[model samples]
Structure formats: C-alpha cells, structure tokens
Target: MKAMSPELASWLRGRTDDSVTVKRLHGDVSGRLFWRVFTGNGTHVLMDSGKIPVWPWIDIHELLRANGFRVPAIREIDTRRGWVLQEDLGSRRLLDVDDGQYMKLLDEASDIIVAMQRRLDGRTCADSIAGRRSFTPAFFMAELENTLETLFFRLLGVPMNELLELQREMRTLCESIDPSSVFVHRDFHSSNLMVVDGRLVMVDWQDARFGPPAYDIVSLVRDSYRDPGHVWEDRARKFTLAKGNMNMFQIARTACQRSLKATGTFSFHYRKTGDTRYLGYIPRTLRYLADYARICPQLDGLVRKTYRTLDKYHGEIDLRDFRSANIPEVRSR
Candidate 1:
C-alpha cells in the first residue's frame, strides 16, 4: 500500500496545484504525522493530527502567536479531520545542532521560558485551554504510578513493599514543588524546538497547559533525549522565577518526577510496540534519577533500589520482555 493516501494527496494538490510532492518526516509520540509538501515555489509544513481534536492545536497556536512567540502560521486547515497546512520553518531542530551551538541557542530558548512566565500570566491565559487546568500533585503522582507499574513492578520485579517507601517519599517531592501554575509548553525539549534563521520556533504544543513553573525548564535542561552536559543546576536557575522563588530544590524535585515519567512512557510504548529505541532512554533517565538523588536526599533510597532492581533484571530484560508482557490496570490511590 502507498504511504500517501489518495484523499490526502488530492487534498494537497487541491490546495497547491503547482506542487511537486509530499515527503514524510519522522513523527513523535504524539499521533500527529508531519509532512513537508514541496511545490514549484517552496514548501509548506502539513500537520496531520489524525482523528484527534485539532482545535487545541489551533487555539494554542493563536495564543502563542498573540504572545509574540514564533509558532507556524496556519495557511489552511480542515478542523473536522484535524489537518493543518502551515508555514515551513525548515528542519534544523536544536536536537541536531552541535554542543556549542546547542548551548548558545538553548539560552535563547530559556529566555523564551522566562518571557512566557512573565507575559502569559494567569489572566492572559484565563480563557484558553491552557488556563483550564494546572498540573496538580495528583496529576504528578498519577504519572509516577505509571512508572511504578512499567519500570519498577512489571519490568524489574521490585517488591510492592519496597515501592511503598519510594512512593511515600515521592509524594513529598510532588507536594514540594511550587503549586502556583504558569502557562507552559509541557514538552519544551530540543526536538520540538526548531532553530530557523538564527531563531527558535516552537512546535508540538497541542498539550500545552498550566503547570509548575519549573516543569518546562526541567523538560529542556534535563531533556531525556539529549543531555545538556555537566549539570543542569545553573541552567535551571536562570528560569526558576516564581512567586515562592522556587530554587534549586524545586528544580531537582521536578527533574526526578519528569525523568521517571519519561522513562515510564518509553517503557510503555516499547513493550506495546516491541521497539528497541525506547530501551536506550530507559538507562539514561535512570541515570538522571541518580544525579537528582544527590540534590534531594529523599530520592536516595528510590534511586539506589531502582539501580539494584534494574541490575538484577538486566539480563532478563535484555533477553526478552519477560513479565512485562501484560499491560495491567495498576493504580495507586
């Protein structure tokens, strides 16, 4: 079967009659398919969000655009089917840049966070989807529950009793972060940020919501995909501007939660699809947990136990999926 559907091809040609063709681009966890549509004159980025609601993407795009952010301009859209043809911002993601350039450009990205934190205040975002909900402690723990299931319990076979202590300690970590919410991109990692014409263009923002001020910085500096090299304390401090003056402790606290969350997501997706690429992130994120444990002594036991369990089951995990074959409805209330 052809990768391009007849209807989609017709839709593209219908819009750009003089177009050459469309080329597929690597997609991410989000169910959105991105395409670079080539035409006689230039190219346009086509965002196919599949059967999901496209309004959030459109709504958030306009919100960011009005806030003086560099999001793609929507040229055409089919809101019912979740299709958007927008400006092509080129393909030089910050993820693909060298360390020196990545370091320099990341400062600009960090400044973007500061600007949003300052400009996109609660009142400005009060009517938008981002304003509707904030990342509460319950939400943070719910994400960690997924990690406990996939990584600790299901995959590595850690005992339930052992995880209880970890869970209790992590609860403190969750409750420790600043409760005040700010408009955040939710996933402000390198891959979602495009470096075009000596500037940064943010994308993959459909999941934007009001989260802890440290959430976006944690996602960027301690990015699961790419390491910021050395430590992230200094970089994280630059963006930790909140009402409570949330400091390094909050940054490390947020990192522990976010890294574990990412690790769980990778494990869930890997087991469901048998994809080996997810395996690579598992160890890296675990390492981040170790690093953060030093900053927050509460995570020390959880970190050490995680390492021990992972090491004990390293061979089994490498050999096969083992006990993680079944996706259980594990919940911790």
Candidate 2:
C-alpha cells in the first residue's frame, strides 16, 4: 500500500471535513485504486484511476443512472484528477450471498440486462459514447491476441509462428457473434454487481458499448469468478426468451470468446502482480471454451485446432481434467 499522492489528498480535502479518513480497498485487475472514505457524516468510495482518463466512467455513470440503472451515486468527479467520489454501496458483492439470495440477485441482474436492451435499443443509442463504439470482428480478434500472447505463446510453449491457422479460426469465432445487436455491460459479472439496498447494482460499467446480445449474459452466468452451477443453461434460455432473437448458439459462441478473453485477463493480472489467485480461474474458462463445442458444432475445426495446439505445447492443461488440475503457486513477472 502507498500513501495518497499530495495532489489527490488536496483534492479530497476540499470535499471533506477534518474528520475524514481514507482506507484502501481491494481493486480489480485494472490499475485503478478504490478508497473507502469515512467522514463525520457518512461513508463513500473514492476511485483513483492513477493516470488513466476517468471521463468514460463519469459519462457512463451518468448515462446508466439517467436510464434507471442502480449504479453508485456519484458525489464528486474530476477527470483531470482521474478520481471520483461516490456512494460506497457497501462491500457485499453479488457473489457474497447465500445460494437462494444469489439466484434472486442474479435474476435481478438478468432483468436489468433485458431492460438495458429495451431502453437502450434505438437510433438514440449512437448519441452516447457507449452506443457509438462496438464489438467488431477485428475488435474481438484484438482481444484474443492477448490470449495468444499470454496463455498460448507465453505460458504454453506454442510458437508465435505456429499461430496462423489458430488466429484464422479465432477470427471465424469472432465472425459468428453479431456486433451492435444491443448495449452490453462489457464486463458484467458477479464481482462487478454490488448488493446494495436489497438490489443488484451494476458497477464497473465504463466499458458499456454495442456488442452481441449474449455478451453480457455470457459475462454474468458464465462468469469465471464463480460457478453458478446447473442453473446456467436455464438462465441463458430465459434470457434468450426475453430477447426474442438471441439463441443458445449465439450465447455459446460469445461465451467461448468471452471466456477465452477472460483467461487472458486473468493471466495478464497474474503476470503483472505475481498473484496465484488468477491462475485458478484459467482452467475453468478453458473448460468453458471447450464445453461450447456441443452447442456450436460449426466451430468444431477451431476447437480441435485450439486443443491440438495447446496439447502440443502445454500438456498439463487438459480440458477434460481442468477441474482437478493443480496450478502451481509460481510467481509471475
């Protein structure tokens, strides 16, 4: 832990009384840091993005709040400062609940997804920055390039030169998912959903953009952080019924790509922080990427190619035994 910079402290002083105190909180993979601020009046969370631009957060917060989403209430914001002070929404995340409550909260999150699609589905979507951006095939490949770099080439022994066919297949995987179908909460998952005031409040929505209708669903039910058990298929099916056009195949395809992208993210975080916690998540997502083969038989070639390359390079990562595979506590640079 490091001391707050003089610049950030000074910025906060003006917004608080002398009784205010600050403590660091667990952060996400992004370099952004969060602080729990306690004042004589109440408690709040202060987000410090280090040097990254914070307007996207501010803008997206306003957009979601205006559209009836239960995001944290913004108390103060300074994009140049790269910090935002907002309602704390407490520490209990959607994952930190009992099984029954978990399903209830998850249902609320799913409803939010449907509402998001209905309300944000219009030409007016382009007016906001979220709607203006989209998940294109190239964008999807760019995300997988991280996976190829980290999980395949760097971690596994796959040669960089050996990636041409896999990359082509990955591009095909990207092409199967529809782009700009709906407004997506780019990283919607249990960790990002805070349980506040008895409702599921969506956080970390700065990356909201136009993507496949199944993207957010995939991020939620197929979350890498927690296994939602047997209810997974039922949730996806219900979401499909609510959306009308989205189907199981679409969900399965997006899950394959999203899970792979998440694998790369977990690997990237482990490599950057020397954290072993991220390693446990990899096998699950790899299993998820493999399990979709039944629903997406069209991707059979891609799946076989991926497994062949992995088995050729890394023998320990057998998808069949992924659940029981033991990841060593190796420190990464």
Candidate 3:
C-alpha cells in the first residue's frame, strides 16, 4: 500500500501554505513507516502509521522540547490516521556512526537527560499523555508481567510453567524495589536518538512516565541496537556521577535492574514479530543480567535460571495473529 494518501496530502498542505514536496523513506520497526519530505527552503520528516501507530510520541516530543530537552519540533499532527509531520532531525543516529563519534554524542545526550532530571523536580508536562502517574512497585510489576505474557508466552510460545514462575519472581523483585519517582522516557535507546547539525535530538517519546532517574540512563548504556563497549559505559558513569551525585553501588544497582527490563523488551519484540535483529541483543542482555546478579546477590538464582530458560528456547518464534491470542491479560492498574 502507498504510504501516503490523498487525504494526508491535503492535510499537510493545509498546515503549510507554501508548496510542499513529500518523499517516502523506508523504516519499519514500530509497525509504522517514516518519510523524508523536502520543501524548497527546508526539509521535514513525516511518519505514517501503518499497523501499530505511535501518534502520542509527537505530543511527548513537543513537551520534552518545551521543557528544554532537545527534541524534534512537531510541525503538524493528524491523529485520525496517526500521521505526523515533524522537523527533520537529521537521520545520523548514533548507531549509524563510528564508535568515537557515537560515544561523544552519547555523552552530550547524557547531559541533556541530566538537565531534564533537574527540570523534572515534580514538574511534569501539563500536556502529556503520562500526566502525574507515580511509578510505584505495583505499577512497574504490572507493566513487566503484561509485556512478558503478551510478547513471550503467547507470541514466543513459552511454556506455561516457565512463564508462571518467571512472572512470580519478577513481581516479587519489583515489589521489593524502593520507590523513587523521576520523569522517565520509556524507550530511550540509540535508535530513538538523532544527531542533527552537531546536536543530539531525542525522538519516539510517547511512553514518558514518572519513574526512577536511572531508567533512561541504563536504557541508553545497555542499548541493544548498538552494543557499546566499556568506553561508553565509563563515560555514562562519569556523566551520572557528576550530575546525579550517586555512588557506585546505587548506580550499579539501577543499571542492572534497567538492563533486565530492557532484555525482556528486546526479547518481546523479536518473539512477537519474528524480528531476528533483536535476537542479536540476547548476548548483551544476558551479560547485563549477570552483572545485576553479581551486584544484587539475592536475585542470583532467579537470574541464572531465567537466562538458561531463554537460552534453551533459542529459535524462531512463530507469532501469528498475536492480538488474537487469548493469553492471561494483565491490565495496568
């Protein structure tokens, strides 16, 4: 199917009186399509939602930019068809660049997130989808369980016994977490970051939440798209230490927890759609689990067991009609 529709064109023209040209580009990750548009004077990017629409991200991006975080501006929004025309933050994502360039850019991005944390002193965006929800242990557990069951059990065909035990342990671990609510960007990885004109611009921020500060940081350092080495981790550590003023123990704990959650997400994406690219991340994901286990010392058994289960089931997950799969659904409270 054509990415653009006549109605979409009319909508775009309505937003801008000047003559506009649209060029379709290819990117399929979130079940949506991206397009690069060129105008006489400038350029813009448009995203057309194919199956899984993320229209809310445009609003989130605008809110983050307004709060002094660097992000692409929303030029136009059409939620009816989930299409958005946004300022073209040049497409040189960190993963697209060499290690030296990527690390430097990530260090700068870390500065932005730190600034964002300072601004987030209980001051949430008034016009965001994630208003003032507290990231309590219960809420976090719900998210993990729901994503795991839907993405792993149903889509990956995980055995019932294994799914049950993992869910139980995950819930227990989540509940034991001490509460600290800071503004969180749910998916802050390398893919969602753009290097535009020597500046770092974050994108795909619809799933913003009020959570712990380490949430976004670990997501960046332990990113699956680009397996960064010790150099990036060291830079991230230094950045966090300077701004957050936390010790090694606390930072290590947070990183480990975040990495575990991220591994589940990567596995979910792969199993739900047969996307093997995410599988390449398993090794790194396991490494993160090991790191966390050594630090926590309590989750050692659970971590080792879960890792073995995932490894044993390493194969293509045939996820046909996932939405129709009648798995045990857990709604966020």
Candidate 4:
C-alpha cells in the first residue's frame, strides 16, 4: 500500500504526540479517505476528504447530539481538508449482529431518526451541507428524469427515442406527487449505521436533504445488505408515527416513490462501475415498489409505464445473467 504524504504523516504525529501510526481505511462510494491511527495511549480515527469536509459533519453531530440521539462524538474538525477525529462507534453494525440483536438495533436507529425529525429546526435540512436547497416540484421531476434517462435508459440500454418518451411520462407521473417534505437522510442504508457497545449509531450523514421522510425509511429498510423483516417494519411504522403526524398511507406512498427512484440509482451505479452488488439489490427494492403499488391503485399506471419501457429494452445488456437482464449499458462521456 502507498504511504501517506510526509506532511500528513507529520500532522498525524503531532496530533497524537508523535505516537500515532496511520493505516489507511477504504472509502465508500464517495472519494473520501479514512485512517485508523494507533497511538501509544489509545486509538483515534482520521478522516480526510477533498469533498464534503467537516462543516456538514459537525452540523449533523451537533444536531443529533442536541436531540439526545446516539451518534459518534466529534473530537475535532478541520473544514478545508475534510478531516475529523470522532469517537469510534465500534465495528459491530446492525448487519454484523445476530437476529435478535439486529431487530433491536434497527429499532434504535429508527428511534434516533424519529427524534432527529421531531426536533429538527427549520433550517436543519436546508442550510446544512447535507441539506438540499432545491427540492421543488420541478426540481424533483428533473431528478426523477435524470434517474430515468442517465441511470435507467442510458445505462440500461433503453432506446434513446423510447427514453425520451419515458422521461416525459415519468415526469408527468411524478408531477402528481406532492409529498410532505422533511429532513431526509438520502443514504440511510445499513453500512453507514453501526451498533456500538449496545447502542445504535448513525454515520456517514453528509447527504441529508429536505425531501420526503419516506425516502430515509426506504433507504434503511430496502437497503441492499439486509432486508427489513416484518417485525422491523412494524417497529419502523411505530417510529414513523412518533416522529411525524403523517398517516400510514402517506408514509407508505413516499416509501414507494423513494424505492422506485432508488432502483434506478442502483442500476446506474452497476452500469457505470460494472459492479453486480447493486444489481442484486434490485429484487428487494422492486418488492417494495410492487407491494406498495398494490396498496395504491393510483400508482398502477406508472408501474405499467415502467414495465413497458423495460420490455422495449430487455435485450440490450451484455451480461448473460440476471444482473444483465433488462439492464442498460451506460455509455462513457
């Protein structure tokens, strides 16, 4: 493995009394970097990123902490280089635990999410780095269109002409949705959460947005690493009830729309990176979409529209497996 730059190495040493040894930790989807520093006294985490530096992180840490949620403690922050030293929440996440513990941990996570939402201030999801300033109806439709065309059509092999037509239809369908927006963790999936020392902690929270609350719920339950069981769903519902005054039907509908958007996102990732992991997630996500559609006949037309597009582009992918079936091959720019 490559070594850290001399300046960074010296900086780490100075931070830890010249007793720190740095080992780089792998990053996730984003181009950030993390390092585990072993000091003579104790361990400390060092994170460096050129994008999404410390301000947003500090904002979230402060928000969750003020709301009495269980999250990592921020030790220090440097905004320019995106560096932070936070209290390590340990390695056992929801997925690493046994079935009995998993449910409880997930419940805790849901509770924390609800608490954040309940105590959220007006600017909580707008001015923060994770916040979205543009989620108006037009913006939401454009986002949906980007997912449909770049993620679904262009990446998955739907014909260009058909993609244009589908874009219009999807935009029309999306225009009908006027969801009650709230602070949303755009990527609330499992890996970003950890169960540390019998407490559930949420991490990697630099992508919060002012969008539908159900989007966060969908991000968690419909996560690729683990499926939310019936018990978990029931708990999530209870948590949702405690957080917002929205009815069950509204929550379910928001989850459905979010799931549909996610399917396109996962497909886009797979098509761009040639990684099948995201593709494996589609079935479960589709289950969310299909099940929710069954409850809301209003979405039936949109479902049919998606299927029609899929039918037209069924044979465009190159892989000879489920991952490739009806998949689009995203062209490089």
Candidate 5:
C-alpha cells in the first residue's frame, strides 16, 4: 500500500479519530484515481478526479437513488477539491460472476432497467435531467468521428477520402434513430455493474443522460468484457421487448452505434495511455458492430467497406506492435 497524500490524510484526520489507512485501487480507463480508505467506523472509497468537479456525480447519484436504482451512497463530498467519499460497494463486479450467475444477474439487471424507465415515464421530474443531457445526432456522430480519428486514421492510416465517406454514412445512421426521451447510463456494461449482497448496483452514473430506451439494455447484453452468447442475447432481447415494449430494430441500431463508439474509445485509450489491454477488446466490439450491420439494411454498405479496409491492412497493423510505435498522443475526455 502506498502512503496517502497529505491532503487526503488531512481530510481523513478531520473526519475520524481512529487510525486511517488508504490503499490505491485499480484505476479505470477514465484516468481517475480511487483509494480505499479504512477507519475505526467502516470502509469508504475516495475518488480523486483532479480538475473535474464532483457535483455532476453527486447530482446523478441523488437522481438514480430517488428513481429506485441501486447506486453507491455518498458519505462525504468536497465539490471544489474534486474528491468524494462514498460507500464501498465491494470489488465483485458482474464480469467476475460464473456462467449461470451471469445470465441470472443480467435478467435482474434488465428488470431493474425496465422498472426505472416505467417510473420515469412521462414524469415531470425527468424533464430536469432530460434538459441537461441528451443523445442528440450531433453527439452520436461526434463519437463515430472520434473512432474514425483514433482507430481508422491515426492507427491504421486510412485514406482521408474513405474516412470522410464513412463519417457521412455514420452521420446518416445516427440521424435515423428517433430521439425519444429515456434515462440511459452511457456505459452500462458488466465492468460498471457491481454485485453487492446479491443485488446489481450501478456505478459511474456521471455519464447518465436522456437517450433511446434501448441504449442501456443494448450496452448491457452486448458488452465488451464478456461474451454472453447467442442464447443469452436472445433471452435478453425477449425480456427487454416484453418489459420495455421495444422492438429488435431499435435495440440493434443503438447497439451498432454504441459498439462503434466503444471501439474508438478502446483505440483512443491505447493510443493515449500506452495501454495495450484495451486493444484486445476491439475485435469483439467490431464483431458486435458487424452482427448489427448484418441485420440492419442501412448499415450494409458501410460495414462491408469498413471490413474490407480492415482486411486490406490486416498484416500491416498489428495491435501488439502498436505499443512500440511512435504515435502522437491525443487525449480524449
């Protein structure tokens, strides 16, 4: 365990009389640092966000809790300093569960999402959150552009003309989705879900915003961390349709959009932080995107073109060798 920073130590001293111990926790791709703090009373996690304010997290936490979702409790907060003391939800993530348990948990997760959506449906209080954040066509296209810049252009050295063509297609596809108002946890994958006392708890709520109802459910089933299999995907689809009254096309389209952005995010992380672990997930994410493309007629040409381009540069662009390359760093938020 590394020594606690003076600022954190001082903060702990002010709050507790017992001896305090702090240990650094494994960090996420967001680059935010977390420390597990122990005291005579109990254990807590402190998030150090550097320049980012903690108010959005605090606000979202309150919002989710009020809507009957399981989110971590905020024990203390220092808004100006970008630090938050929150309850320890344990280290067992949904990704750590077994096959049978995984399917069961996902079913429960689907139920929770349906209940939450129903609770917020047509409610005036939802208007406040919807006003602040949303998944507009512009936002969706920007994410696709991010992937094009990082993965296609920078990493693979794709031709500018081709990149532009794909960008246009992506923009069109993004614009096709109906801009329905619903709560969406932008990154509701297995890694962001913690299993505490047999209940699935959502974390990283800062990115929650208004988007299509199928967005979060697609993210949950077609996750990058674990392959939930075709059987599970079918089960999930049936459950979602029954619970939320959504159709297959709506879910598949959102999945395609989300998977493309996720692939770009993985490439961006590897390029920026010199971390190759993220590259391993790109192939699976691309497969998910391709699956959706096969089902959606509008995405056929773009997917075929992109796959052909990838095959053309197959031997040349090795993800393993990328770490040794002299690529310029481009940081993304």
Candidate 6:
C-alpha cells in the first residue's frame, strides 16, 4: 500500500485530533479510495476520490436525505480535493445476509426506492444531475454494442454478423420504451446498499440520473450478486407494482436492458482490471438477460443465439483465477 498524499494528510490532521488514525478500506471498482478514520470520539469514513468530482455525490445525498432516505450523513467535504468525510454505515451489505433476511431487505429497499420516486417524480433535478445523460434509445443501443464488443466478441467468441443482428433487435426493443423523467439511482444493486441500524442505506449516488422508475426496481430484484429465486422475484415485483405503479412489462424490459449492460460492465471490468470476481457475475447476469428475454418476444431469437454461443464454450474457461497480478490485497479496516 502507498502512503496518503501530503495534502490529504494535512487535510485529515486539520479535521481531527492529533491522535486520530486513518486506515484504508476496501473499495469497489470505481477506483475511489476510502479510509476509516478513527478519532478520540468516534469513527467516520473519509473518501479520497482522486480526480473524480464530489459535487454530484454531495448534491444527491442532500436530495435523498431531505426526502427521508437513509443516505450517509455528510460530515465534511473538500470539493477541490475530491475528499469527503461521511457517517460510517458499517459493512453489512445486502449481499451478506441469509435468504429470509435478504427478502425482507429487498422489501425495505423497494419501499425506499418508491418513496424516493414519489417525492421527486417529474421534479427537475439539480442542474448538475440534469446535465448527465438520460437513458435514451442511443444509450440503450450503446449498451448493446458494449455487450457485443466485450462479452460476445471478446469473451464468448461470437461472430460480428451475429452480434450485429442481435444489436439491431436490442435497439428496436429499447426504442419501444416511452421516455420517462423520474429520478433514477442508476446503480441500485445489492452491493451499493448497506444495512445500517436495521435500515437500508444507499451509497454510490454519483451516477444517478433521470430515467424510468422501473430501472432501479429491476436493478434491486435482479441484482448480479445473488439470485433471489423465483419466489422472491415475484414478491419483489408485487411490491414494486403496488408502490411504484409499474407494470410487469415495463419492469421486464428495464431488466433486460440493465442485464445487457451488466454483462458488458462485468466483462469490461475483468478485461481492463483483470478482476475475476466480476467474471463470476457474468453468468448470473446472463441468466437474468435470458429470463427477461422470455417475456420480450422481440429479442427472443437473438437471445437464443446468445445462449448457444455461451454453451459452446461453457467448460473451457477458469474465470475464478483471473485476478490482476498487479493489484495488491487491501484489507478493510
């Protein structure tokens, strides 16, 4: 592990007593660094975001907190330094729980998402957030292209001609969705959610944008970390339908789109960083894509071809051993 920068050390010293200790915490794929800062009084997480800006996270945190959502409380921020001190929400991810508790947590998460949408629906987002890209036909189509380039071509060895036809079908399917202007948590999966004080707390708010309400719901229920099984999936659908007023088709369509993006994202992460943990998620994400494709007849044949390609090379790869040789093991404090 490398030492903290002089400016960051100075900043931390100014924020706490001289006896305070700062230790690095395990970070996600976003490349941001997190530190567990222990002072004489208590503990807090210091986010050193490197070149990434902090305004979006700060703005979204305020918006969600004002609406009674359980986002981490902001203790301090230095937008210029790309650092923030936030309330420590602990380490219990929704993915770390048992099946029974997982379902209950999903129900709670569904309620929170619905509440957020109800409060912010049709309301213009902050200028910074509003400026971010909306989920349009082009964006959906690009996600399909990303899947074809990274997952099919690079990983599964599918031919260009097949990928092009599949891309066309996916684009057509995406074009059918009516555009929505509701507030959306672009990455609302299990890993970004923490269970704190027996409540669900959402993190990683910087990527939020305006889009369809069903997108976030689909993200939660069809998360790549763990399979919620058919029973929980149905329960989640019912909860979202009653709270978010989204029909099954809308949810399924969003799930298909999101799952396609997930496959590309997982593959890209593996290829770029050599992180095999992400590769383990590809199969589950594909299963989600396959399941949702059944409900979307427009892309059925393309999906069938995708499965055939995956089956062709099913047993040849050892995805679990692809961890990057250059990356160091960093333990969470």
On lDDT, who's better, 5 or 6?
A: 5
Worst 10 residues of 4 by lDDT: 318-327
Better of 4 and 5 by lDDT: 5
Per-residue accuracy of model 4 over 87-191 as CA lDDT, tens digit each: 766667677888788776776777666666666645654445545443556866666766776555665667777667766656655665546667666677788
Candidate 5 regions with alpha-carbon error over 4 angstroms: 1-4, 122-131, 314-316, 319-333
If the candidates were sorted by their lDDT against the true structure, best first, what order would they fall in?
2, 1, 5, 6, 3, 4
What TM-score would each prediction reach against the true structure? 0.90, 0.93, 0.80, 0.83, 0.90, 0.89
Q: Each candidate: how many clashes?
A: 0, 0, 1, 6, 0, 0
C-alpha lDDT of residue 31 in model 3:
68
Q: Name the candidate, 1 or 5, with the larger lDDT value.
A: 1
* Residue pair clashes in candidate 3: 182-211
Q: Pick the lDDT winner.
A: 2
lDDT of 6 by residue, 2-72 (tens): 56798888888898877889888888678889989999889999998887777778877777777777788
Clashing residue pairs, candidate 1?
A: none
lDDT of 5 by residue, 1-333 (tens): 344578867876687654888788986766667988888888989888766766777777787777777888888778888878889998999999999899899888887777766765546345445337889899999999999888888877788898888888788879977578677777888999999998899998787777888888888889888879786458556766676566677777788888889989988887787776777777777767666776677778777777766655432244322223322233332
List per-prediction Cα lDDT, in the order shown. 0.79, 0.81, 0.67, 0.64, 0.76, 0.75
Give the best candidate by TM-score. Answer: 2
Better of 1 and 3 by lDDT: 1
Total backbone clashes of model 1?
Answer: 0
Tell me the tens digit of each residue's lDDT in model 1 across 169-218: 66777887778788889999998999898889999988889988888988
**What is candidate 4's TM-score against the reference?**
0.83
Native RMSD of candidate 3 (Å): 6.8
